[model samples]
Target: MDSVPLFALNDCDVMTTNGSKLGTLENITLNPNTGELKFLCVNPSSEESTEFPQMENGQVVVPVDSVETTREYLIVTAP
Candidate 1:
């Protein structure tokens, strides 16, 4: 994975990676043990959302590996 600067995250466009709007970051979940990413309806408090993906109208899982590029925002391959 590429080294993403902290500042870039502020302007990230989640739609490209997670198939949602850029600002809808509330709907996502992450696994703590294996560090795998997946789609969740809503957040469940500070449970270590390490690899969470932004969800939209429909749920879609954006695996960490599918992230082709990320700088200001994440760009993932479409399923």
Candidate 2:
């Protein structure tokens, strides 16, 4: 997989493969030693914010593997 700078993805909208809007990318979790992306912190849309389980510190930590990037949005698959 190609690596992208976290700054380039900040504030990007997040959506599902089905085209459902989930939220916006707020932050990222990285491995200190490897610099690998670990989690994507998302600020969820009001409608679905409460639907996700695993949210922490006001942001949802989405697994990097579930994300598919595009010019306009970060598409994520539900695990």
lDDT of 1 by residue, 38-74 (tens): 4323322233332445344433445555554444455
lDDT of 1 at 16: 46
Residue runs of model 1 more than 4 Å from their true location after superposition:
5-11, 15-28, 36-59
Highest lDDT scorer: 2
Among these predictions, the greatest TM-score belongs to 2
Q: C-alpha displacement of 78 in model 2, angstroms?
A: 0.4
**Scored by Cα lDDT, where does model 2 land?**
0.78
Error of 1 at 48 (Å): 30
Q: What TM-score, over all chains together, does every model reach? A: 0.39, 0.82
lDDT to native, each model = 0.44, 0.78
